[model samples]
Target: MQFENTREFARQLDKEDKLSRYRHEFIFPKVNGKEVIYFVGNSLGLQPRSAKKYVDEIMKDWAELAVEGHFYADKPWWDYHERFSEKLAKVVGANPSEVTVMNTLTVNLHLLMVSFYRPSGKRYKIICEEKAFPSDQYMINSQVRFHGYDPEDAIVEIKRREGENNFRTEDILQKIQEVGEECALLLIGGVNYYTGQVFDMETITKAGHDVGAFVGWDLAHAAGNIELKLSEWNVDFAAWCSYKYMNSGPGNASGCFINKKYHNKKDIPRFEGWWGHNKERRFLMEPEFHPEPTADAWQISNAPILALAPYLASLEMFDEVGMPALIQKRNKIVAYLEYVLQEIDKDVESTFEIITPAEQEDRGTQLSVFLHGEGRELFNYLMEQGVITDWREPNVIRLAPAPFYCSFEDMYEFGQILKKGILSKQKV
Candidate 1:
C-alpha cells in the first residue's frame, strides 16, 4: 500500500500483478523505437493484437461467400451482433435480453431518445450535468430544438458548487427534484469526462424516476472503466462506445441497454427499421413493424458486421478476464499513479493538483491533474519521451493508467520523465 517512486518498487508491484501478462495482448505505439507508456485509454484504446485477425476473418468471408456471407460466414453476418449480447451484458451488468450492439454512442443516444425523451405540455425539461461532453451537449440541444423548445428553458444543467471540480450527489439529486414535474428526461455521463468523477447512477436514476423522468446514461467512459449494474440500477436506457476502454477500433460500434420493462411495447415510439422487426417474420416484409421483444427492437439498421468484429474480439478478452479482475487492478494502479504524481510534485517546483475525487469509489482509471506553473510544453515533452497522455485546456493533463496495458513501472517512469521535464524548464 505504501507506494515508493522507484523502478524496483514498481517492478515488485508488477510482479505481484495477475493482470500484468495481459499487456502483451495489445500492440502499443513506439516513440524512438520503444513502446510508449500509454495513458490515453480514455480517449482511444490501443489496438488489440487480435483485432487484425477479427477483421481479416470478415474480409475473408466477404471474399469467399459474397452476398451469401450473411448466412454462410463463420460468424454469419446477419446474426453477427448477437454474439455481443451475452458478453457485453456481463461487462455492463445487464441481462443479455436487455442489451444490444448498434450505432455509435451519440447516434444510439439519439435513437434511444425517440423512446425515452418524450416531452409534452408541462413535462418537457431535461436534466443533465453542467459542461457535459461537447457531443452530448450538441445532441441535447438539437433534440430539444427538434421538439420545438428553447434549450435555455428545456435543458436544466446541474452546476457544481462554485469552486468544486465535481458535482456533489446531493446537488444532482436536488436539481432533479427541483426540475420535478417539468423533467421529462435525465441523461448524464456515468463517468464525467473532464474530472473523471463517477456519478451515483443508481441513486440518481431513482431520483429521476421519482420525479417522473426517463433516465439514461452516456457510458462512454464508464462502460468498461468502472463497474456498472445498469439493470439493477433500473436505468431506463443507456449507451456506450466500444473504442475507449472497451479496446475496439476508433469510432467502432456502440453497446446499448434498454430495461426489459420497455420491451415489446407497441405504444413506445421509436424510429424503426427492418432489423428491428421480428427475426422469424423479417423475410415476410410486412408493412407493419412488429418490434423484436428486446433491446434489439431499437436497431434501425442491420448490424455493422465489420465494425462489430473488433468489438467481439475485445469482448472475448473481457469475458476471459472478467470485470472484477479489471477493477481490482484499476484501483491499485490508479492509486499508484496518484502516488507517483504526488512524489514527483514533492521533488519538483511545479504543483500537480489532482482534480479527480480522492475516493476510489468516486473515480475510475483517469486522474485529471492541473499542472500549476506548467504549460503545454510539459505535455509535448511527455509525448516526445514516449508518454502518451491527454491534455485538456488550461494546463490540465488527463492521465488514465488503464489496467489492461498500463504497468506500475509506467507510473514510476512517467514520474521520472515528468520531474525531469519540470526541472529542465526551470533551468531555462
Candidate 2:
C-alpha cells in the first residue's frame, strides 16, 4: 500500500481502522497538555481504563469477606489464576490446559530450566542467541554454573556476522545443526528485544527436537505483538511478562506455556508449591504432593491476585479484539510508518538506518533505528517535543506502533516530529 506523509492520509486510514476504538481503552501520558504519541508498548504498556475497576473489585472483596474471600469473593481468590487460562492460551496459541498464569518472567524461566535443561552424559551445551536480554544471559550463565560447568564451554552463542544488524535464519539453523550432538537445550527470544526480529519457532523447535534437545522461548516481545504457536510448534516450555506487549500494568504477573505432551509426565522435575497440587486434594494438605495434570503443575506459589488484576483487564481486551485483528492493523500502520521513515531518509539524507528486518513476517510492531551522527541529541529533542519512544545505548531509538492503542495519526505525527528533531539537530 502506498503511504503519504500527510495528516489527511493518516486520518483516512484511522477512519478505516476497525481497531481504532481500542485507542480509547488506554490512558495516554500527557505532554504540554496534550497526549503524547505512545510507542513504547514493547517496554511498559499503557494502563487500561478498566484496570482500576478490576483492582477495586478485588480490594472490595478483601474488605467485605476478609480471609473468607478466598472462597467467597465474586471471583474466588482460590481459583483466581484459572480465570486467565483460556484467554491467554489464545494470545500465545496453546490449549488452556497447557497455559498457566503465574510468577514473573525470569523466575518462570528458572523453574522451567529445572525440568527442561537437564544436561546428561555428552549433551550439556545450551544454544542461544548472542546478546540476549541481560536477565536471560544472567540466568543461563548462573544455571550453567549451578550445575558445575564452565559457561564458556556449556553455552553456545549464535553471533551475527560482522556489521550485521540481525541474525540470519539459515545461520541460526546451521549453528543448531553444528552443535546438535552436544546441545541439550535451545533457548532464544521469540522476538529479539533490540532488533525486533521474530524467530521461526516452529522450524527451530523441530530442529531442536530432531537433534535431541529441548526448545523454549522468552516471549517478552512476542506474546501479544505477533503470532505464536507454542503448542503446534511443540515447544517444551515458554514464559513471558505481561507488562510489555500484553498491556498489563508494570511488574504485572506473567504467563507460562508447557506443551500438553509434558502435562501428564509426572516424572519430569519442577519446582512445586501448594497451588500446583491437585485441586481436589489441596484442602487435604496431604504430605504426598499430587500435582495438577497441566501446566499449573509448574507453579511454586499461590497466585498474586492484586498484581494479576490489571492483566485480566488487558486480557479481556485482547479476547475481544483478538490477535488476528490486531496483527492486521499492525501490518498496515507499520507499513505506513516505514514508508514515512524512508521518505525522511531520502529527503534529509538520514544519519541513521533501520536495523529491524524489512520483511513483515520477520518483524512485529517495532523498528529499531540505529542513529549514526547526532542520534542521541535528536532522540532527546523528540522527547522534548512529546513524541514518546524508547532510547537504547549506542544510539538506537525504538519506535513501536502498537495496534491496540496507537493510531495512524500518531505515526504521521511521529514522522513530522522526527523530521523536526533531525532539522533541529542540524541547526545545533
TM-score of each: 0.99, 0.99
Residue lDDT tens for model 1, 178-198: 889999999999999999999
Give model 2's TM-score versus the native structure.
0.99
Predicted candidate 2 versus true structure: per-residue lDDT over 102-160, tens digit per residue: 98999999999999999998999999999999999999999999999999999999999
Clashes of 2: 0
lDDT for 300 in candidate 2 is 73
- Clash pairs of candidate 2? none
Q: What is the lDDT of every predicted structure here?
A: 0.94, 0.91
Best by TM-score: 1
Clash pairs, model 1 backbone: none
Q: CA lDDT of 374 in candidate 1?
A: 92
